[model samples]
Structures are given as structure tokens and as C-alpha cells.
Target chain A: MECYSELTCSLFVDGELTGDAARHLRDHLVTCQRCRDLVHALRAESRVLTESLRELPEEAPSPEAFSHLGFSWVWGDLAMMAAVLALGSTLFIWIDHLEIPGALEWFNPFSLNGLTNLMFNLSYYFAHGGTAMLTEYVAVVGGLFLVLLLGGSVLLLGRRWRLPKNGLGLLIVLLTFSLPGFALERRHEEFVTIAANQTVDDTLLAIGNTVRVEGVVNGDLLAFGRSVEVSGTVKGDLVSFAKRTVVSGSVEGRIYNFSQSLDLDGQLGHSIYGFTQSLRVADRGHVGDGIVAAAGDVSLEGEVKRSVDMLLSGNADLSGSIGRDMTVTGRGLTLTNTARVGGNLTARVRQLKGVHIADGAIIAGKRDVQVRVRKSQFARSRFYFRQALSFASAMLVGWLGLVLVPGFFRETTQAVGSGWRSLGLGIGILAGVPVAIVVVAITLVGIPIALMLFAAYLTAIYLAKIWVGAFLGWILLRPTGATRYDWLLGLLLGLLILTIVGFIPYLGGLVRFGIVCLGLGAFAWQLYHASRPAMTA
Target chain B: MIVEVEEGVVVEATSSEPSPLGAVIRMEERAQLRVAIAHLPENYRLPLVLRYYSELSYDEIAQQLGLRRNHVAVLILRAKQELRRKLAHRSK
Candidate 1:
């Protein structure tokens, strides 16, 4: 018989050979020295192979070794989210309660006329507020929140996602220095004083008890103090936030002032916009452009080369020469004998008798007086119609979300089981993101990012209620045979319920806020969980 | 000359003649052989390891690998051959 095949010898070494085969191989090996050597070598090879494999480490470390580390990391992410949320909500509530100067006091939500007035006032403020409106506290807090959010996200998510380590380091460094506190350290000057002979070529920022500029400033002047006095020449805009602002200089650009009282005794190349308690233009004051002010009392004794628009809470006394139209909405208006309006004079006051014009006061164009009237917003059919339209639009958005990302809703709804946790996360994201966006916008280079963030923030806010509505609908219906259509039906019912609750005077606002918190929290929770690495083998 | 195995002991074909090859492998040679086996391909390595390291029978290896009984035997033989070649090349 031929020598046993190496395959047969290997099987024999493993003791896998059957009775007849094993007996034959053993008999063959004894007679053939070559086969015997083959058998011996095979057995030795088998022993070595088994020992080597047994000594080798597993391909991946056992899951038990990493389970604890992974769990802690997940909890770390959750804690970070909660902390940021709490801090953000506190800041938001504080900012909301702040009594901003020049804010409309006649902002009656129950009147359509009041809404129109609010829109007009908001447009005016946005158009003229300029950089002075950006509060320092907001900028600082926003910067800090931005750094924490971005840095935390990268650090927490980077390892699991295997993001490039070098890039993460660079990003962390960039986020650290982007804080407004760091930037302010280099640019802020406390108790700034520019001497008579001094000239500042770069934009000047001064924040202290008092800011006095007596020389030339080639760039914009930003001053925030108890008292801001500028008796110099400003080649660019002058933005001042102070208790009292007095300008006796020539400003080549516009003037934006938010103060208790603003006195202009200088030449303005452009417009003068002031949100103040009292604003006065002295006899020597000359404005090349228009004058726009929201003030308690406005007295113009100088000359304005363009129109004058004033929203007053007390009264407007115009003794100066206005080259264009004059529009005043206030408690009362007065035009002295020296007052000269080259164009139309329009006054909207509490009463027509509140407008007093001297016989000698020259108005070259039409003079119109409108008596203000209060109307109930709920009385108007248009209000209900508008509300319906808004409701429909919201429903459309919710429907789209449901259709396109059903999985997302499922995940969010699942997270809603942890209610308080979701609420905390929700408050943080809602309040924190806007502040971060504002801070980013303050940095000119980050404007695009700010815009994108703003869009996302608005979308999140709009969707918050819808997400909650869907969850509510699902709970109430609890269809035995659930389907896509069943979810839609539940969504409709839930939205209807929410809408009715939202119409309930005082409780509506509170319920709406709760729903938003719940929805936003659940959404954020889902996102966090989704970002976790897949640990299952 | 005739050789026969009555039970476990080997009776040489020629009386008073000892075995030509050494049955016992040295510790260093066994270590070297183990390293060679580790370097074997997955198809060969897996069955070889399963058979020896795991102390599985041919039927068990075939069940794990989803292969025929005879095919497993062939793979193990190839695995041993590859390991021998590697060890020989390393010694050179």
C-alpha cells in the first residue's frame, strides 16, 4: 500500500481517524520510516500550534474591560449638557427681566395697533442701535458658553468618532482665545482720557466711571461709563452708553447714544439717533442728516438738514429749522415761533389738542394731527385668522418632520421617559444657543456661523412644541395597531389640544413653556444618545 | 525486515536497531514552531488552532468552520506544511 497521505497523517495526529483508517495508518507508519517521521512531525506541529494559539491575545480586548470607562464617558456628556442648560436658562431669564432704556411702554399685546407700533419701534431700534446696543455682559457670557459648548462637544465626541487628534487640539486652542474676555483685555481702557493734543488712529473702546475725549479720534469711539464727554473730532461714528452723554465736537459719521440724557452741541456729518430720557440739541448743534430719537423729552433748538422722527413718552419741543418732514408720536408736541419745518409735519398724539404750533412757526407743507385710539386685538377677526394661519404653518412643519425623520421622533419620544433630565437639557440649549450666536455675530469673522446658528435656533424653537405635541398625541391615543397614519392622527389631535391650551389667558404661556422644555430636552437627549459609539460586537 | 506495533510500543523491523529520528522536540524548536503556526493564514490557522488548541474533534471543527470532514483534514495538513516552511526559512 502507498504511504499514508499527509492529510491522513494530520487527521491521525489529531486522533480523528476512524477505527479502520487509524489501524491502517498505524500499521503503515510502523513499516515506513518516512511515514513514521511524517507522523512524528505532524504531532509536534499540532502541539506547537495549539500552544501558540492558546498563548495569543484576543483580537480586541474584552468588552468588560471598557464597559465601565464607556459608561462614565456617557454620563460625563449628560452632566455637561445639564450644567450648560442650567447656566443658560438663568442668564436668559435675567436678560429677559432687564429694563432696557427706550423700550416701548405702550406695548399692549391685546391690541393690533400696539403690534404695528411695536414693529415700527423695533425696526427703528435695529436700524439705529448700532454696536452700542451689544451689552458687554451678553458678549462675555456668550463667548464663555460658546467655548464650553464647542470644546465639550469636541472633547467628549472626538475619541469615539476617532476625529483627527491634531485638529481637535487646534480647535480647542482657537475656542479658548475666541472668548470676549481675552479680547477685551487687549482693547478695554478704564477711565479713558484723550488729551487735547492726543489723536487715536484706531477704534477706541472706553468703559469706566467716566470717559472724556478732548482730541481727535480717526476711528469709531465706543464709550460706556457713568458720564461720557466728547469735545473732540471723531472721523467715524460715536457710540455711547452712559448715564449722561455730552458731545461738543464734530462727528464725521453718525451718533448713536443710549443714555439718561444726551446733549448735542456739535456738528454731525450724519444722523443722530438717541435712546435717552431727555435729548436736547443746543443752538450751536447742527445735524447734516436726519434726527431719530426715542426719548422722554426731546428739545431741538438747532438746525437739522433732514427729517426729524421722534417717539416720545413726554413731549417734543421743536424750535429749530428742519430741512425735511417732521414726524412725532408722543403725549404732546410743540412748535415755537422760531421753529421752521420745510416739509410735512405729522403728529400722532393722545389728543389733537396736545399739538401746539405758534402762528409764526413755518410749515411749508401739510400739517396733520392724528388722535391715538386704543382698540382690542381680540375684537378683530383678522387676529383669529392670523392665528389660524400660524397654526397651519406650524402643523405643516411638524408634518414634514414626522415624514422625513420618523426615527428621530421615535428616539426623542423614547428619551421623554426621563422627563426632568430632558427639561434641563432643553432649557440650556434654548437659552444658551442664542447667546452664543450673538457673541459669534459680534466677531465680524464669525458672522456667517452666527447666521447659520440663528437659523438653526429658530428652527429648534419652532419644532419644540410640535415634538411635544406628537408625544402627547401618541400617549393619549395609544393605538393598538400603530401605523404611520396613526401617528399623523395623534399629532393632529395633540396639536389641537395644545392650541386650545395656548389660548387660555395666563396658564397658556406657562404650559407652552413647559411643552417647549420637554420637547427640546427629549430632542437633545436623543442626539446625545445617538452620538454614542456602538459598543455591541 | 519487519516492524509491528503490538500495543503502544514499537517493534523495530530489524532486531537491536534503534529509531533513526528523535521523537522529542527541544524547547527552543517548539517555540519556533509555535511562532510559525501563528503566522499561518486564517483558513489554515483557524482549523489547526481549533483542532489542537481547542482540543476539538474533526466533526466539531467541521461544524464550526462549515466544511466537510475531509476538507478540514486537508487544511490542517496544509497549515502544518506552511508552518514547517516558515520555521525552516527563519532558521536559515
Candidate 2:
């Protein structure tokens, strides 16, 4: 209807309009010079955006973003102070728990009640229970402290002080630390009977978290996970469904790996089978059998012992050698200088990026490598890596600033301490409540409350160690006269002490454990203190 | 001989067969027949196919999946047929 609308319609056909409203607005563009000009401007803007989109960096969230989100130094400083106080308190608790301890058999997380009962019974019969109790208290408290410190250090540093990040990181670290226990616990809880003498069926074994097969399979082997690495040999066809599938071993059988990323580095005795978003074949490896792969990005660096049939959704780099024949269908295919092929390469549709063959590089067969220029996946990875590096650097800078500025450090530490105290107390109560319920179910009397109190005692010891470790890390980072008269040297010296002393054998462990306990204690105190106000008010 | 697959026949195909596609169709036809006889659920198909080719027997797979004997056989056949056709189309 309008001249501008016609231009806008043309722009939309040329891939300008992203939303339905933009498409609908094309009607108004035809009648107005302003709208026509707007369409032209939008077209120019689109081109600019597309060109620049490839250059945008993928980075971690910058430390400045965190600061902007409001992680004040006051919180951190309080955390540091509370941690210091808790460490001292934990030492006293540790000594007290050990000295008054009866039988230490109940100190483990597994069978607390029965062990405690045994300990009390043994205390009445023999004085040996006191020694055992002391040993148990020391071991349990000490071990838990290590877990907490390791978890917290990873949390504080890995998250760069975001509450959600810290919590998630800590959970993962703790879960990783408790993996062996968790695995056993899962097995115990889920299964009633174990099938003995049942050899893992190769096919049944195909579906697993991690499967490494060495023999030939009579059928297709489906493998998948965060990482599925096949380095051994496979007899039958291999098919994987995963994020990443790496094949470094020989596959006598055909291989089909469907993943986000796939790698083939060994000889495929049969036809190579693969469909990945990104595919790579190593230089030393050979696909004796023909290959079929579909990828967003395909990189061929090695020898294709046979024919290669690939449909690249994005861009492909063909550099290595192919024996019989090669055919690539993609947005763009680049032939590198070192690439070699014995057979003709034919593509029904080919997009060429840049082909650079060296003087010495030989194409024994026909020059059938076709080309059509189109945008591809490499452009995207470049953009992402740049952003990631930028964010990481920014966060690093923020952390360095927090450590360097004394006032800032004090404030942040204080906030962290207050948070830890509240969190610890809440966790302690939550942990105790379950045990109390179970005890009451069994005893049907006042025994449940007593049992809960006992559970709280154990949990407190563990949490205390975590807080103390963190506190020790901060306090130990004092300005020592390492470099003569240099302020920078003093800062470096503090960091050095914090890292080094906190990792040493006996002394570090004790100090770290103490800090952790203190943090836990502070958290418990805060929770109780907070809850009391609501009850009273 | 080129045998056209009826709407529902399952075929089994191995690399050694004259045509991988033909064998796959056979596997599919057999699987379809089994599924009807056994009256099994749809979800059991993939695991059953994977188990069939591997060292697992019908009984073992049935036990693992918490299913009946006939259902496993049905699932395995159906899965075999589906995979063969999907893979054939994908390879092209």
C-alpha cells in the first residue's frame, strides 16, 4: 500500500524482521518516506549487528556485576570476624567433647544411636570407652572440619561471592567429597537383591554413565554421558548419544556417535558412523571404512582410509588425507595447506570459506572440491571464548580488589560471618529434627528430644570446623615483612601465607577445622537468635 | 528379491546382509508382530532393542525392566525395526 512498506517487505524477505510485529509494520512503510528511510536504516543496523555479533565475547559474570548486585564489604568483614571467634570456641568444644566422651563407636554418621548406646554401656563396664570417645570425637570433628574448609574455600573462590553460586559450588564440592558414601547409600536404598554371577551383557552394559568396551559387539553399542571415551576396541557397531564422544580405540564394527561433539582418532575397521554437532578426526587415525557424519562444524585432520560423506550444517575444515572419495555438503568448507586426498571430492552443494593448499601438498585425484561461502560455527566459538575470558578477568579483578582493600575486605568478611552463623544454626536444627522424629518413632517417649539434642551436638562439631578453616585463612593472611618497605610486597606476602599455611600438614588442618566450627556456631547462634525474637514478639 | 514391507513388518539387518536396508525391514516386521502379541508399553522399545543385540536375554531384560517375558520380546522387535529405518534415513 505504501512505498516504505514495499521496502520494508523486501527487507523482511532479506531476513531483517525478527518479530511478527516487525513484519506487520511493513504495511505502514510503503506510504511514508520516513518509514522507507527507517527500513533502510534498519537494514543497515541489521548488517552491522550481524557483523558485530560474531565478535561478542562469552565471559564469566564480571566482578563489577556482583558488586553492582550488592555484595558489600561489610558482610565479608563480619564473616571473617565471626570465623575467627568460632575457631577459638571450637577448640574448647573439641577438648570438651573428647574429655567427656564415653564410647566413640557412635561418632560415625552411619549408626549414631546404636553406637552411642554401646558407648554408654561400655563406659559403665570398662573405662576404655572414655579413650574411644575421645578418639571418635577428635576424628569426627577433624574430618568434618576438613570437608567444610575444602568445601568453603572452593565456594568462596569459585563463586566469587554470589550467594547462589557459593551455595551450589559448596553443594557440588560436598557431594563430590561424599561421593563414595552417596554411591553406597543409593545402592542400599534402591536395591533389595543383588544379582550375583550375572556378567554384564555387552548390550545392557552399553547404557551406562561410563562404558569402556574392548571387544567386538555383535550389535550396535549405545554410549552416552558428559564424556564417553572409547579407547579400547569395539567389535560391533558403536552408537553413542552424549554431549561428547571420544573414540581413540579401534572399532572393528561400524560406529555411530550422536553427540554435541564427537572425535574419532583410531582406525574404524568397518564403516565409520557418526552424527555430531561438532566432529573431529585426528591426523594419526584412519577410518578404513567410509564415514558418514553430520555436524555444525566438522574438522578433518587425519586420514580417511576410505570414502568420506559428511553434511556439515555450519563450517568444515578438511586438512588431512582421504583415500577413496570425499563428498562434503555444508555452508562452508575450507581446504587447508597440508590437506591431501587420493580420490575425487564431489559436493552437491558446497560453500567455500578459504582453501589454502601448499606447493608441496598433493591432490592425487580430480580437483572436485567445490565451494560456496556461508557463515559457520567457528565464528560462534570465537565470539563465546572472548566473552568468557572478559568475564573471568573482571571477576578476578574484583576478587583482587576485595583482598587488597582492607576496609572492603573487613566489611565483606563481616557479612559472610553473619550469613554463615544463621545458615549454620538453621541447618543444625533441620538436621536434628529428622533424627528426633526417628527416635521418637522408636522410643515413643522423651527419648526423641534427647536424641535430637545429641544429633545437634554432632552436627555442631562438624559445622564449627568448616567456619574455623575459613577464619584461619583470612587471619593468616597478614602483612608480613617479606619484601622490604613495599606495600605490594606486604599484600603478596599475606596471600602467600594464606595459601601456604592453610595447606600444611598438622597445623593447617587444626586451624582450618577450628575456623569451620566457628562459622557453623555463628550460623546456629544467628538462627536461634532470630527465631527467638519471633517467638517472644 | 525386493520385498516391499507391509505397513507394520519388523526387519533385522546386520552388516553382513545383502542389503542393510532389507535386513532392517525384516527386523521391523518381526518386532511389530511381537509387540501386538505381548501387549507391551511403548517406552520399553529402545532398551529392549539395545538388550537384544547385546549379551542380555529376554528374561534378563524383562527382569531388569520389571516387565513380562512376552513384552520384552515385543519391545525388542519393535525397537529393532524403528532403529533400522531411522538409521537408514540418517545415513543418507
Please give, for residues B33-81, the per-residue lDDT of candidate 2 as tens digits: 3323222233543243224223245566567567786665555445534
Error of 2 at A339 (Å): 2.1
Residues A1-537, candidate 1: write the lDDT tens digits: 799878888778777887998999888877899999888776655554554545432311112223423455556557766766665565445433422112211211223443455466556669986443233323343445555565555445543344357756855765564443233311334467888899888766665567888998888787766788889888888877788999898888999887899998998899989899999999999999999999999999999999999999989999999999999999999999999999999999987678899999999999998888656767888878987898788778777776787767766765665678888767666656776664454332244556666897777777777778777888899987657787777778888899889879899998888888788778766665554322111
Model 2 chain A, poorest ten-residue lDDT window? A185-194
DockQ (C-alpha) of model 2? 0.01
Score candidate 1 by lDDT. 0.71
Chain B TM-score of predicted candidate 2 relative to the true chain B: 0.44
Task: Candidate 1: give the clashing pairs.
Answer: A85-A428, B2-B13
Candidate 2 local lDDT, A475-501, one digit each (tens): 554435422223333333433444356
Provide the lDDT at A251 for model 1: 87
What docking grade applies to model 2? Answer: incorrect
